[model samples]
Target: MKRKNVKLMMLAALFPMLCWAAGEQPISLGTPTGEIQGRVMLPDVERPPVVLIIAGSGPTDMDGNSLLGAVTLKNNSLKLLAEGLARRGIASLRYDKRGIASSAAAGKEEKDLRFDDYVADARGWIELLSEDSRFSGIFVVGHSEGSLIGMLASEGNAKVKGFVSIAGAGHPAYEIIETQMSNQPAEVRQLVKNINDSLRAGKAVNDVPVGLMALYRPSVQPYLMSWYRYDPREVVACLEQPVLLVQGDKDIQVSVGDAEALKAAQPQAELHLIENMNHVLKSCDTVDAGVQQATYTNPDLPVVEELLNVIEKFIKP
Candidate 1:
């Protein structure tokens, strides 16, 4: 279907003019440990602004697809965004996290990655991009949890010019998760509360329901704990580079409060709150569940032009 066509087109491009309009192509960044899987597209113009894209959490690929039900790779936001940027004379690099995408050891190791492992991989990419002459400078666009990784990789690093935090969490991650769960049905909310309480008490959450266990398991605990150790506000405050905050006013996952928190921490960061836009940066449906899930399946939907304009203007300056 649509996904197939897009992927085919992305891999078949030759000339640079419409290269960004093409689908996602495999990019290999040779790291110390091994090669990392990613997709890179350059604009038709030479020496375009290079933007590195980092995806959110849980099996998300370079294209912003997640394994969650009702969401597929077909609705990949980054895929279209990168392609759009290419058509606009911007270069981009988007990658699958270690063990995702086309990595040879994918299924086996993705489940075991630590937070530091992701940060190290990002650093490696930064180093590689810095050495390349085609790119003027690295501008990192991090979505959701990837924003944290981008900040971690760019702190005190002179190579990165700026950061675009899209749907990023400003407070502690667990706090945001807890807040969202608090409004769920009483049973679901209570179940999550109990599991969180157990974790906070230094006890294993094994007895929690299977639905909750998927998000709170031993394999993910190390990362959750590490994530709790730093606050996005604190991290952003330490970063000297320019930052742009992009948030969807209707996004149920991360609220405007998150963006406000970031702005308060870093007064210089630019904030762009797109009205009616959801977590995925697409036009949302008026209905409840429809809007939250629409962007996951509709690749034709484009991100808010206002947001893109802000980013382009910032990078150009």
Candidate 2:
């Protein structure tokens, strides 16, 4: 649960698709919130299933970029995923959440970002595909933090034919945050717990620690509270369509236990655990901490074979 490895992969030497890459045509999808901007990569085949690629947390751009420094990986994981899926005859649509990239217009920006806003946005994408006769099926692929959002959005939506929860958390956001903060000093942990407890109780805390102000600040608390309300395990349990739950063992951001929890909630889900794969969905040995982390920023590395195989089998079979 501490790792985002649940974030995504498995294609080895699949660069052949790169030569045939669709190059991701720019797309502006209309939604209830506003205009959602993203790129659409289609396979050469006809009647392909369309995948809506949802990115993880933070300020991740459409191509899996974080303008906020510290994340230097320009490999374009989402873009590459779209390419790989396209090669396998699956088209994909990946976009920046509300205010990040092309969707940063005044009326459509993140003035008051909430968890449900993303869910609604995802449904908007589903509605778009439902109108397109070319796509016979619509799938929602949620990675890292997007797993929860995808699950909630696709659960009862008739337009979404399948759900893929990658590197998603099975626990509630409060428990996940608490697990992430386990190494913190007792005082800091208690402060976070108190704040979350108050928020869960439908109360807001005005006094906050300077150190944790960024995470629990007044502006972000409402979204955090909304996020904590939706338990991923509960959300997955409600999904009636086929589900593919995939996790990377060496993922530093998400843990295997989260995937197992998801499987427990939905016994029928097809679960695949990839060994030596990090959260970003790259195939490589995790013996060295630096190498493990390097894949996050490695642009040349391709998705592992195992990932592509399962995804293709799930969607085409």
Candidate 3:
């Protein structure tokens, strides 16, 4: 027991050195609401380009885990991506969105949360990176719903050198939701369409049905209204910085056609469609919904190698 204790002490003393060698550290940004918490992964190289990685929708933390009810979706996709970039001589900063994980104190009341609030937080991070001298350049990488947030944040920001969209939808949020609900019964689909139409018109839906209450709850309708106003293609087309659009053919949630549509919007942007890569950035052999969902909880599964390669080239090239 004495020998084991000594070894543990030695390992604890060496842990900081190991982290320094990998250039991993906790970072934070102060906002009017609260402090937004994040993790920064830097390479050993001097003045490396840093990418701000914005996570997808919901309660996704800095490491890409999402809490759905009692279940925690523990795919370390963003964490692995940051580590991979650090290994390739690039730096990255990934954060828990306001009101998520460590940054829970920064969350606003559900009724007061606007989509622009997220955009503001992302812009704050960009400004923070701009003031840091250790980074030679700043890039924005947005995944899923974050793609739209990053687009709005990077639109007129001169400090943002580039933007990358991964597994992003090309249309507005309402259209995407409509597509996802197409398999429901005609009555249900029509009900959803009516609710969406009301939200799209800048109206609050107060009389939500019991069956659809979870999705169209009163507190969340304001946020949905804000989210439905922007078309991603329109936003991406306005970006002055270089853009890279990446999509996976096997991504069950987002389609490759969405990336193509984004490319069509910005003719100068580069588009790469990776084969067999799923929404979580893992290479799944099949597109079975159950099989793809398994990757979401499997932290041991590493993200696709081509994802790292393409992102590295985009940032360094």
Candidate 4:
């Protein structure tokens, strides 16, 4: 449960069958509004453990890529992660959340979207996997915002044997947003704080400043209110299954402190802090802004090896 440096070569030597072939198939789950789309990677083994991969926030797709304006943030983090797990003889399913990519049709109007909708979708996936005979165990791996969603869904679910939180925030969404805005001008920071406080209190602010409108807009306020209600530490503590908390020392978004807080909340949870891993799960040698940006946009980079190692051990141990 403590942080340790893992040698890639050593892990490779210990698990020699790291190149096993895995079959990829498109999977779907029907929701009340529409269908949620996903990909299932099944290794060539009978009754392998299946991990339900939940992606991060925003327009991120199943492959962990999101669109920023006209350009695409093309890191295939989740896709490569699923493939890595499959190669390790573990099955995985990564899905595009509603309002994202192929699942766009399943999205409701912004005002109608609530954080619990995502939790419901995750639970639906759990039910679908529970009835499948190919998978012997069910595990949930959530990254960033998805981490909290996975915790909520996995809590009290008998089918989920384990849970993994990667680059997940330990605090509520509002607090994290406030911390990220710490360097802004005092007035701007105060504006954001006031809005966040209102949202956290389940109240909607009608007049958001022009500069902050995109983030605190009236249409998105309801979803923000729903999201800010849950404290990640509290939720993770409620989970009865084994938990693995993984953080990257190099990650700028979610700090090592957040992972430590999560581990503290759940004393029995295992925690691993991988060296040089970034928010996108790729290894970056420097914290240079440009280099970090490149890691986010590069699709060729594989996820950090230590991450896959820690996860494999947690799932198979």
Candidate 2 residue-wise lDDT, 21-79, digit = tens: 44467777776656879888888976678999999887777777666665455657777
Can you write out model 1's per-residue Cα lDDT over 22-128, one digit (the tens) per residue? 43456787654567788888776767889999988877888887765664645778887787777777789999887775654533353355677788888888988
| Model 4 agreement with the true structure over 260-282: per-residue lDDT tens digits | 99999999999999999999999
Lowest-lDDT window of 10 residues in candidate 2? 7-16
Q: Mind giving the per-residue lDDT tens digits that candidate 3 earns over 1-317?
A: 99999999999887755545456888899988899999989898877899999999999998889999999999999999999999999999999999999999999999999999999999999999999877899999999988999999999999999999999999999988889899999999999999999999988888899999989999999999999999999999999999999999999989998999999999999999999999999999788999789999999999999999999999999
Model 3 spans > 4 angstroms off: 1-22
RMSD of 4: 10.2
- In model 2, the runs with Cα more than 4 Å from the true position are 1-23, 106-111, 287-289
Number of clashing residue pairs in every model? 1, 16, 0, 0
- Full-model lDDT, candidate 2: 0.82
Ranking by TM-score: 3, 4, 2, 1
Best by lDDT: 3
Output the lDDT of residue 124, model 1: 82
The candidate with the higher TM-score, 1 or 3, is: 3
